[model samples]
Target: MRLALTFLRINVMNELQYRANFFLQVLESVVALATGLIVLSLIFAQTDALDGWTRPQLLAVLGVFTMVGGVIKFAIEPNMARIMSDIREGTFDYVLTKPVDSQLFVSVRQFRLWQLTDVIVGAAVVVWAVVTSDGSEQGSVTGGGVALGFFVSLFAGSLMIYCVWLILTTGAFWFVRMEMLEELFTGLYRAGQYPVGIYPGWLRAALTFLIPIGFAVTVPSEALTGRLTWSRLALAVGFVVLLMAVTRTVWSWGVRNYSGASA
Candidate 1:
């Protein structure tokens, strides 16, 4: 934790030197949030609900999506993504020489501090949605439940994201052109913004079993809205543990396969 804080502070000091970038980040976040909220609002305008979900309920889910998505774009996605290029070009050896775990080092080596703007904006949207749609109107969620669900979902979502990246980048073990796989992951991650129930049954099932996104966004928000089932929460936790194990196994196999351009 200390190391993360130290890295965060250093990043803050560095960013302060370039104030212009801060405003640019805020502007970008505003545009992104506006576009997301507008489209959802327009869709709800056509109908009272989408798949048993009202406007505020869906809006809450959207807020979680943005918060998680921003974190990925800002750091997790960008850092882990460079793995393939680094391996192909022989630049990853430097990371091997460092004292930290190679996986952790690679996963969070950089901070796109600007993306925190999206996190702030997402929080605002979620709070407003909750307040505006109190009681059964928003499905009878308590403050305690929402807090608990937020952390639970954050952990599950982050774990699934890490696993997906690990598996995709691990492809560099056998092939050089792995960006295609990463592109596919990006598209699916975007689609995760909507409730899984919003999609067809097959696609929803795929997201739950194949990709593990079911635990990431939907289940977390469901907890906040008093809509989550105990069975689903258990399943989410179990899925996160299982996927983390699988990702570790694959990562070890990939490292063993790596020759590092030196016989």
Candidate 2:
């Protein structure tokens, strides 16, 4: 924790040097939020509810999506990108020489502090949606259950994403042209902007079991909207554990096979 904090502090201070980026990020966040709101409005205008989700409920999903995306951009994506670059450039040896675990070091090395704007904005939107909806059509979620379930599910979801991302990034060990991974992941992540229930059965299953955007965005939104069940939450946690194991196995294998640029 201390080492992670040290790295975070350094990253924060370094990003603080470029204050203008903050405003740009804020602008970008607002524009994206506005576009989402417009889409929600259009969808609601067509009908009263979408597949069972009300406007405010969908809003909560959007908020979770935004917040999760912000987290990915702020930490996971940047770090993963760095690892890919290091692997390609032969500089990953420097990371291997360090005393810390390679995965831990690479994971915490880079932080885009400005990307946090989306997190703050998304949280605000979620609070607003919760207040406005008041569990109407969503569920009767209230009291401590909402907070506890939301946070727990959110953490698990984010960690699951990180694990999957690392597993993909680990492909750098064998494949030199891995840049498409980022674009592909980003494209698939957009599916999280809405409730997975609206999709066809097969796509829903793919998102939940194959890709995990369903767990990442939908489960947390379900928690916030009082729709999450204890069993499903348990399923999410179990799935994250499974993904973690897979990620570790893949990373270790990759490292063992990697000959580095010098080799």
Candidate 3:
């Protein structure tokens, strides 16, 4: 943990040198937030509720989506890119020789400090949604339980996402040209911006179990809105453990394969 924080501090200092990136990041976040709000406005204009989610509830979901997407863009996406590039350029040898765990080294080696604005914006959106949703009979965000659930679910969801990325990037050990794998995850993640309940049963199941964006975005938002069920919470916890185990197994296999080839 100390080493990871050291790397993060170094990355932040380095990124500070490129001041123009700050403005560009802010612009990008504003545009993304605006686009989401416009879409929400259009959808709510047509109907007052979506899959039993009121406007404020959906906004909370969007907030979770934005925050999770920011985290991925900030950490996971950059590292995945680096993993692919290292493989392609034969620089992975240097990573393997490092004293640190190779996966940890690769994952935290890069940071985009500006992307944190999305997290701040997303948190603000969630707070606003919760405050404005006070009068609602259903989907009301209240009490310590809902807040605690939101944070817990958010952490578990993030681990699930990290595992997914680890599994995807682990494939690069064999398939060197798997740079497009992140794009595939991005495409799937877009589906989580809205309520998963509106999708077909099969699609919902796929989002819940197959891809896990539903658990990452929807389930956490549901927690905030006081709609999360114990069964769903159990499922989320189960998925986190399952995916973490699978990712570790796959990463070990990839490392062994890489070591053998290098020797």
Candidate 4:
């Protein structure tokens, strides 16, 4: 833990060199939020509700989505990409020689401290649009519930996304160009902006199983909005375990495969 924090501190010190980039990051986050909110407004303008989610409820969900997506895209995803690149280019040899667990080393390698603004802004949105009002009677979540469920959802979503990335990038043995798939993952995360229930049956199933993205954003949002059920909670937990196992297996296999490829 101390070593990780030390590395994180080093990353921060390195990032301090480019303070201008942090301003650009803040600007980019606001622009993205405005675009998302505008689109949501336009959609709600056409319909009273989307998938049983009212305006405030939808706002809360978007808040959750933005926060999770920010963390994943800004730090988690980029670090995973760095891992895959290192693996393919022999830089990972440095990691292999280290005494630390390679996966842990790669997983938490980078810390883009500035991108945390998205989290703050997203939380603010949830606070303003959902938690501030007393709508307990309206079947929405209590503020306490939203806060608890938000962290739970964020944890589950981030773990699941990291595991998925591990599984995806671990395939770099034969497919050295798998970095392109991050583009697809980015698009899928964007799709999480809306309620997954609005998707078609097949699409929803794919999001739940094949990609398991809904858990990353929607299910947690559901919990925040008081729409979660035991079944969903169980599934989220189950998938987290399942994904962890699968990603580990794939990463191990990839290591062996890469060894063979190199030979």
Give the count of colliding residue pairs in each prediction.
0, 0, 0, 0
Error of 1 at 262 (Å): 14
* Candidate 2 lDDT tens digits, 114-146: 999999999999999888885743444456878
Cα lDDT, all candidates: 0.77, 0.90, 0.86, 0.79
TM-score of each model, in listed order:
0.88, 0.95, 0.94, 0.92
Instruction: Estimate, for each residue in 137-222, the C-alpha lDDT of model 3 and write its tens digit.
Output: 44444467687779878988888888888888888888889968888999999999998899999999999777888888988998
Which prediction has more favorable lDDT, 1 or 2? Answer: 2
Tell me the TM-score of model 4: 0.92
lDDT of 2: 0.90
The lDDT, on a scale of 0 to 1, for candidate 4 is 0.79
Task: List candidate 4 stretches off by more than 4 Å.
Answer: 132-146, 261-263
In candidate 2, clashing pairs total: 0
TM-score of 2: 0.95
Predicted candidate 1 versus true structure: per-residue lDDT over 1-263, tens digit per residue: 66667766776787788999989999998898888889998998899888887788788888887787777767676676678778888887787888877777677656778888888888788887777764442434445766776678777887887787778788887796677876787788878778898889999998877776666778877876668766666778888888888888888777777855433
Q: List candidate 1 stretches off by more than 4 Å.
A: 1-3, 9-18, 137-143, 260-263
RMSD of each: 2.8, 2.1, 2.0, 2.3
Clashes of 1: 0
Clashes of 3: 0
